[model samples]
Target chain A: MKSFLKLTYMELKLQLREPVALFFTLAFPVMVMVLFGFIFGNEAEELLGGYGQVDLSVPGYIGMVVGTIGMLSIPTTLANYRELGILRRLRATPLGSSPVLWSQVAAQVLMTAAGIILLFIAGLAIFDLRIPNGNLAIVPAILLSAFSFFAVGFVLAGVMPSARTAQAVGMAIFYPMLFLSGAAMPRYIMPDFVQQIAGLLPLTHVVILIEDLWLKGTWNLTSVAVVAVVLILGLVISRFTFRWE
Target chain B: MTQVIEVRNLHKAYDGVTAVDDVSFNVDEGEIFGIIGPNGAGKTTTIESVIGLRKPDGGSVSVLGLDPQTEARKLGNRIGTQLQEAALPERMKVWEALDLYASFYEKTVPWEPLVEQWGLAEKRNTQFGGLSGGQKQRLFISLALLNDPQIVFLDELTTGLDPQARRATWDLIRAIREQGKTVVLITHFMDEVEALADRVAVIDHGRVIALDTPDNLIASLNGETQVLFSVPNGFEAERLEKVSGVTAVHQHNQHITISGNGPLLANVAAALAQHNIAPADLRVQQANLEDVFLALTGRTIRN
Candidate 1:
């Protein structure tokens, strides 16, 4: 346990050094929240099921945070580690490779939580956003959403041949999911066909799950099942595809 | 002498294509054993197999009396490896890397002194990517020694360093041996083997072509020595050819090369003096491991 904490601490410190990761996880979501909150007032809107734009957008922004960390940060960093033989180097030591892998995951999870916290602070400070129904429930909601995305990220990193390819493929998947999954805009505002497509995306389920818990203090069982299935499926595929070197 | 590492008939193939075949060697304690070969000659594969980083398709490897495959974790604690293409995270600070790797082993020398001893005291806060090639290698050497392993394996440790850094690294390697640690030095540079190895296994085409002391390998070439000089306008090569221990002499225009055995340079010099022909550019060249490799493999080590 001590070794695991040390590894995770070191991993977090290393991840914090990356400017691109910081921009995406810490700054990008806050930027979007401020921009959207300014355009739409904080008053509860009938269109958003009586939730203010700040309240509704905060949970969707959390989905974006999960996506950015899982789809961009995790894949790019792990793939680069593999490409540079860092993973193999650690594997040669007496500690083997498991500590490195778990530490990386733990660091990403911490970063995801930080991004969510930054979003909440922005919502509260800028727009007088109301606190959610069940404050205690936010922990599991954020964790499960972050975990599901990390699994996808791991599968992408596992299969990508190089870091550059991983980044490119991650961006390719991320940008589209970001826009169509109600992460950038509300699903109710989109056309019917676009909403149907959004329903099929993993991020859409994440956004639904987070917003349901934040506003109603209840789980969206369907979104919960979809996100859970993605986590399991990603894990299975990564088992067959992950390459250390 | 105690044998710290033993490998017998180790065979490894990738996708049915052989990378190492029937390669065998033993490393004695407190000696620098070199595995010298050209690229793709199975040098890395052979060492990786012995270190348990690779699983051999055939043969057995024993390091510190433990099976490398079955007891890899135990063996890993006793042996340290600086792999050829392995690297740490670019953003990892020097001190952080030392501290992290130090945590891997059950016992370790304090990393602060280790880094200072490796001349990285000033670069403790420097990130891995900020280091020069030589500094990076020094950091790796320090990391490898963190556990104070009984045996250390270094693969291509000086591949990219400038001449001065290469020599400095050679001294560091000698220091490792001076600490009573058995060192496995792997390289394609014959000079590296000649300078440091107590015994070298010359690998080629995934096989151990020759294994002996560097001096013995060079001496196996009939101990041939060459004398070369630029002669005056019309000097007869026959004078030097008739000298005892002179096996062959070739003259091209103003240049003459004499190949022979013991004291050939002295005999040729005596004969040349008798003729009053004192060539100012005269020089003696002794056969080295490159020649031994060429003679064994029918090709130069590089091509």
Candidate 2:
């Protein structure tokens, strides 16, 4: 436990040192939130379900945070560590592969949470959005969703051959999901066919789950099941095929 | 002598092609063992297997009486490795890396001294990516010795280092051995082995071709000292072969070449004096490990 904590501390410090990771995990989400607020905050029209744009856009930014950290930040960081033999160097010590990989996930998970908080503060200050009912209930849902997305990152960390490939693969998946899942724009603006396709992707589910929790103050039990299944599948695939090269 | 590491008939392959086959070696306590070979000759692969980085197909590897494959975690406390290509987090500070690596061991030496000893005291606050190549190499050597392991493996450790830094690293390695630690040095640089190895294993095609001290390996190749000089116009240069200890003599234009095992230069000088031939452009060349390697493999170590 001591060693794991030490590893986690170092991992978090190292992650914070990376400008690219900082951009994806923290600054990007905050940027998106402020932009969404400025563009659509003051209007009283119903853009997201029944709330104003600022209230609706908060969940989308959270989903974007998860997506950026899971798809772009975590996978690319792991791939770079592997390709550059940072993982191999650790293997020579008492701290083996599992601890190092887990440390990365833990660090990114914390960063995702921090990004969400930043988005929340920015939302409240800029758009005058209020916190929804049942503030404590959001923690479990956020954790499960983060795990579900981190599991997806683990799969990318396993399959991608290089950091460049990981980045390429991450961007390939991230942008489309962001646009289609209503993370980049209001979901009401998306066509019905686009919304159906978005529903099939995991990011859309994350956004909806966060949206429902923040707006309606109730659990979306069906989205929880979907996330649980993905979490298991991602774990299995990554465990079986993860490469140290 | 205590054997710190023992390997028997290790075999490994990748993607249906053999990388290491039938390789075996032992490292005794407190000795610098060098492994030198041409590219793709499986030197790195052999080291990886012995260090438990790979699972061997056919043989057993034991380090400090523990199975490397099964007891790597246990062995990790006793051994250290500096891989051919490795890096820390780019923005990690020097002191942070030293302290972090120090934490991996059950017992650790004070890292403050390591920083001073390695000439990295001022660079402690500098990020890893900001360091020069030599500074990075010094940092790696310091990190490898951080745990004060009983045995250490270093592979291609000084490939890009400057000459002064390379010399410092060699001295640092010797200092490690002076503390009664064992080392396994893998490098393609013959000069590095010649300067540092107590004994070297010459590997080729995944097999140990010769295992002996550097002097013995060069001697076993029948390497000869050569005497080259331009003979006075008409003096018979070939006649120097009759002088004791000269084995082969050849003449190209006015230059006479005399090759022999021992004291050939003295004998040839005497023979020339006897003939009253004034030798000009006098030169003597002794065979080195590079020449021995070329003779043994018929190929250069580097592409």
Candidate 3:
């Protein structure tokens, strides 16, 4: 256990040492959120043209926050380690191999939380986006979304072992989740068939749960339950199929 | 001497091709044992299997009397290994790598002395990717000794090193042995086997073909010596073969070659004197490990 924590701390320190990656991990998502928020502010409703009267930019920004931290950052880092034999070297050490995986998960979780906080701060300060009326529900929504996306990232890292493949696969999942989950475009604007397929995606469910907490001040139990199920499924699949070397 | 490592009928196959086939050897305490083989001859696979990096299909391997397969985590603290082609992160500095690996063990030698002893103090802050191959090899060796382990495993330690670096590494390996640590060195360099190994097992096609000291293996070849000399004008190959202890003679232009077992040089000189032919340059060379390897395996070590 001591070795696990020590190795995890080392990993976290190493990740933070890369100035560019660190900046992008923390600052890029917030920059995108603020840029999109200012560009789409007040004009969001006008552009929506009576799509349930909900401010479209709020859900869009939330989805962006989830997608950047979850989809883009996680898979690339995991796959790079596997390809370079860093994971294999660590596994040969006395430190149990699970610590490396868990430490990465922990780093992503911490980074995701920071990114979400920045998004929230930017939304509240610049865009005048108010906190959800049902403040208690937002916690579970964010937590579930983080876990679900992390699991997706884990499975993606496992299946696509190469760094190039991880990037391609991350982008492949990222564009769809970004566009289809109402991050860039409103989900209400999509065709019914597209919405049905998008609804099956974990990102879609995460966005829906976040939208419920942030905009409506209510807990959507069914959506939260779906997110929970997807999180479990992703965890199991990654655990069984993950190849270290 | 007590056996520190023991393997019985170890076997490993990858995708239906056997990498290690029924190989067995033992390393006594404080002895530098080597497994010498050519490329793709299962040296790395056999060492990794003993270290528990790869599971053997059929075998019994015990390190310090602990089963590596079941007690890998526990045994890892006691064994130091420098694996072939294994690398750390590019941006990881030498000191960072050292500190990180040191943290994995319960008790670790201080990094300062290791850095000094390995001559890496100047590059401690440099990233791993920035170092040259010899520097990286030194750092790997430092990490392998960081835990102050009772046994160390080095795979192809001097594969790409220059002659100077190779000799320095050989000295360091001897230093490790002097410190009373048993070592398992895997290499294809016959000179390395001759210089450092106390006993060597020659592996070919995943099996041990011969095992003994370097001198014993050479002596076991029945004392064949190669004698070469530049014959003067008017010297014939037939006249050289008639010399005592000269079993056969082959000549190319002015150079004469003779193969024999006993009193070769003296008899050749006597015969040359009788023929009034004094060779300009006379030289006799004894057989080394390379000759023994070729004779036993029917293939040179490089091949």
Candidate 4:
């Protein structure tokens, strides 16, 4: 346990020391949130007709944060570590193997929290958007979604041998989850067939839970259960396929 | 002497090609043992297997009576290693790497003295990528000895070093032995083997072909002497052969090489004097480890 904590702290410190990684994981997400919030302003409601009656900026910013911090960040970091032989070197030491993965997950969690807070601050200050109705429920819902998406990213990184392939794979999953989860385009506006397919994705359940808590002031038990199952499945797949080299 | 490391019929294969095949050897305590072989002779594989980096397909390997695979963490604390192709992060500072590795061991020598002793004190704040080849090699050696381990393993320790650095590293190996730590050195340089190894095992195709002291291996060559000198005008090969201790003489265009058993150079010089043929540039070369390696493996160590 001591070795694990020491090594994990070392890994985190080394990663945070890199300005490039700091920008990508921490600053980039917040920048995207601000950019998208301005672009979608009050004009977004008129473009999508009545369904866009709800200003899509807040939910959209949250979704982008989840996607970037969870899916894109996890796979790229793991793949880069593998390619650079960092993972191989760590495996040779007495450090516990699981801590390396967990440290990455922990960093993502911290970044996601910072991103969410930044997005909220930007939403209120720049877009004049009010806080969501149920602050208590929305927090847990967003956190659960982050956990699920990060797990999926971990599994993707573990299974893919190369960083380029992992990046491509991460995007392939990320964009669709963002677009179909009512995060980019609302589910009510999409074609019925597309909605049915999106419903099967884990992100769809997360978006549903977050939207319920934020806009409706109520938690969706069914959506939360679905997200929980998907999180477990992702964790299992990652554990079985993780390769140090 | 107790054997600190023992391997029995160790076998390892990668992609259907065997890297280490039925190899076995024991390294005794407090002795500097070297594994000398050409490239692709399975020297690294044998060392990695003993260090628990690679698992043998079918054999037993024990370090200090502990199974490396099962007890790697415990055994790792007691052994220090400098891998041939291992490297730390480029952006990591020298002191950071030292501290990080020192954290893995249960006990470690202070990094300050080690930095000064390894000549890395001036580069303490420099990143690993900024170091020269010699400096990097020295840092690797320092990291290996940080734990003050009972056994130290060095793989191809001086592969790219210049002659001066190589000699300095050889002295360090001797110092390690003097400290009563068993050293297992792997290198293809016969000079390094001859200079520092108390005993050496030459591995060819994953099997031990010769194992003995440097002098013993050279002396077992049956007194083969090489005599080379420029043949003077009117020197006859038959006269050189007729000299006592001269087994054969080969003449190659102004140069003569005489091979024989006892006092071959003296006999050749005497015969040349008798024939009034004083050869210029006379030289007698005694057999060394390189000659023994060629005799046994039919190939030079470096080539």
Candidate 5:
């Protein structure tokens, strides 16, 4: 238990050391939120189903936070360690490899949560973001979003041949989802066919689910079911694809 | 001497291809036991099996009198391994790596002194990726020694280092032995075995072909020696074959080569002097481990 904490702490420090990853996971989301918040203030807009622009976009940015950590951070770290034989080295020790893995997961979760908190504070301070209507389901909805995306990241980390490949694949998947899933831009403005494709993405479900819980205090059943299915599939695929060396 | 490791008919295969065939050897306490073989000759597989990093399809291995397969966790605490391809994170600092690994064992030596002893004091804060090859090796040794283990396994420890770094690593390995810890050194380098190991197991094609002290293995060659010198053109070098301990003589223009056993050099020199012929470049080439390996495996260590 003590070693787990120590390892998690070290993992966080290492993640912090990577400037690019730090910026994308923590700073980028807040920057995008601020940019959109300034351009379109918290005025109720029919284009956003009557919710204010910042209020509606805040939930989507939170999805972006969860997606960045899941698609970028987790896969890159694991694939790099495996490529370098670091995971195999740790496995040979008395502690074995499980602690390293668990600690990594813990650190990523903490970083994602921290990113979300930073966005929340930014929205509240500058844009006077509307609070969720006391729906406790918002907490679980955010956690579920993190879990669904992280599972997909693990599958990518397991299957990718190297760190560079994992990063490339993650970027290929994440950028499209970020924009088309309405996490970066409103999907309502996109073409009908593009919106149809966005509906199939897991991040789309995370965005819709979190927004529903945050704005209307009601669960979107289809979003919940889709995210749950993605979580299950990612878990199953990672089991067979994961390689220590 | 107490035996700390024993293996019996160990066998392993990967994807239906044999990696380690019926192999066995014992490591005695307080001695550096060397396992030498060419690339892809199953040296790493043998050690990994003995250390419980691999499971053999047949036979058994015991380290520290504990079954390596079942008691691997317990054995891991008592043994230190610096594997051939294993590495730490590139961005992991030397001190952080030490401190983190030190937490894995139930008992550990202070890492500060360990880094100092291994000449990694100055590199304590340096990231692993930034260190030179020699420094990375030193940090690995320090990590292996952190648990204060009774046995240490170093596989191909100095394969890529320069001559100076190799010799320095040899000294560090010797220091580990001086602490009364049994060391297992694996390499294909002949001089490494000659310089450090008390006994060597020559592995080839997934089997133990020979096991003995370095000198004994070399001597097992029946004392084969080569005497090379240049004779005058058209000289009858064959006449020197009758010299005591001289087995055969070959002449190639001005060059004469003699192969025999004990004191063949002196006999050939005396024979030449009696003919009033002297060669300044005369030298005796004694059989070493490389010769022994060639004689045993019918191939050189490196392809």
Candidate 6:
């Protein structure tokens, strides 16, 4: 436990020290949210089945927050470590590799949460976007959605031959998911085939889960069920495939 | 002598390509043991097995009396390793790397002193990517020594350094030996092995062709003494080879060269003098590790 803490702290320190990771994970989503708040204005636009634009944007950007941290930051760090032999080098030490991995997970959780918080603060201050009524369900939806995204990243890091390849593959998957799902725009506007393809993406499920919790007052177990499957799939698959060298 | 590491008939292959074949050796405490070889000669594979990085296909390895594969967790804090082509995160600072490495061991040397000892004190705050090649190497050496390890493995630690930087790093390696730490150095560089290794094992094509002190290996090259000078007018090269202990003599351009075992230079000198021919540039070149490799494999180390 002591070693874990030390490693987590160092991992956070190392990651946060880099400007590129900080911008993509935290600042970029917040920047996009600020832009969305201005474009939507004080008037509520009917989108996503009569939900206000602000109502949809908040949940959608929250999906971006989790996706960016997961698909961008997590894979870059892990695959880079593997390419650099950092994982193998650490395995030779008493600390082993669990701390390095858990640290990444912890750092991702912390940073993703921070990005979400920034979105809320920006949302409340700029657009007066209030938290929806089903706040209790929002917590589980966000956590499960975030875990599934991180799991995708872990698997990418494990399977890619090098950090450069991981970054390339991760970004290729991330940008499309961001645009096709509800993260960049309302999924309701995408063509039927595009929407169906989005349905295959975890981000689409995350956005749906969070929006169901935020816009509708009802708890959506179906969305919860899908997100849980994704969560298990991500964690189990990544764990089995993770390689040190 | 305390045998800190022992390997018996270690063998390994990758995709049916043999990397290490029937290799065995022992490392004593406080000795600088070198594994010298050409590329793909299984030097790194052999060391990796000893350090528990790879499982041998056959035979066994024991380090500090514990099996490397099964007992790696126990050995982790005790052995330091600088693996070939391994690296730290690019943005990691020198001091942070040192501190992080130090945190892994239950007992650690003060990282502050190691920074200075490895000439990395000035670059303590510098990111790894910002440092020069030499500085990065020093940082790696510092990290290897951070735990005050009982044994350290350095594989091609100076493969890319300039001659000056290589020499400075060599001194640091000597200092490691002087401090009573067992060192395992793996390299294809002949000079590096000759300069720093107390004893060496020459590996070629996944086998140990020769194992002995550097001096013995070179001496076993049949002296292979090389004497070269401007061939005096009418100085007979064939006559020089006829002298006792002179196996062969050749003439190239304006120089005559003699090569053989035992007192070739002395006899060549006498023959040249008996002919009353004086060559100003006469000098005997000492046989090097490259010759030992050539004599064993009939090819240069670089090939």
Best by TM-score: 1
User: lDDT of each structure?
Assistant: 0.90, 0.85, 0.82, 0.80, 0.91, 0.85
lDDT of 4 at B132: 88
Model-by-model DockQ, in order: 0.76, 0.67, 0.57, 0.34, 0.70, 0.60
Clashing pairs in 1: none
What is the per-residue lDDT of model 6 for residues A101-145, given as tens digits with 9 covering 90 to 100?
887788778888888888888877877775666477777678888
| Candidate 4 per-residue C-alpha lDDT over A1-245 given as tens digits, one digit per residue, 9 for 90 to 100 | 55555555666666677676667666765576566555554443534442222345456557667777667777877876777666765665555467667777776777777777776676567666655443687777888888888888888888998878988888888888778877665688799999999888777777778877776778899888998887899899988987766
User: How many angstroms is residue B6 displaced in model 3 relative to the true structure, after the best TM-score fit?
Assistant: 0.8
Which wins on lDDT, candidate 1 or candidate 6?
A: 1
In candidate 6, position A58 carries an lDDT of 81
Could you arrange the candidates by TM-score from highest to lowest? 1, 2, 5, 6, 3, 4
Clashing pairs in 2: none
Q: Using lDDT as the measure, which candidate wins?
A: 5
Q: Lowest lDDT 10-mer window, candidate 3 chain B?
A: B232-241
Better of 3 and 4 by DockQ: 3
Model 1 residue B76 CA deviation in Å: 1.2
Q: Which stretches of candidate 6 lie over 4 Å from their true place?
A: A44-52, A133-137, A190-197, A216-218, B229-282
lDDT by residue (tens digit), candidate 1, A1-245: 55678899998898789888899989999999898888987898787777787788777898999999999999999999999989888878878767777888898998888888888788888888888655677678778888888989999999999999999999999999999998887788889999999899999999998888888888999999999999999889988888888
Decreasing lDDT order of the candidates? 5, 1, 6, 2, 3, 4
Q: Proportion of native contacts in model 2?
A: 0.69
Positional deviation of residue B23's Cα in model 1 after best superposition, in angstroms: 0.8
Candidate 5 wrong stretches, greater than 4 Å: A44-51, A133-136, B226-260, B263-284
Q: What clash pairs does model 4 have?
A: none
CA displacement after TM-score superposition, residue B271 of candidate 5 (Å): 11
Q: Which stretches of candidate 3 lie over 4 Å from their true place?
A: A17-24, A42-62, A121-129, A133-137, B229-258, B262-284
lDDT of 1 by residue, B59-113 (tens): 9999999998888888888888899899998999999999888888888889988
Question: What local lDDT score does residue A110 receive in model 5, on the 0 to 100 scale?
Answer: 94
- Which candidate number has the best DockQ? 1
Return the TM-score for each candidate structure.
0.95, 0.92, 0.88, 0.83, 0.91, 0.90
State the displacement of the C-alpha of residue A120, model 3, in Å, after optimal TM-score superposition.
3.9
Which portions of model 4 show Cα errors greater than 4 Å?
A: A17-20, A42-63, A117-125, A133-143, A182-192, A215-217, B14-17, B38-40, B160-168, B189-191, B229-245, B249-256, B261-303
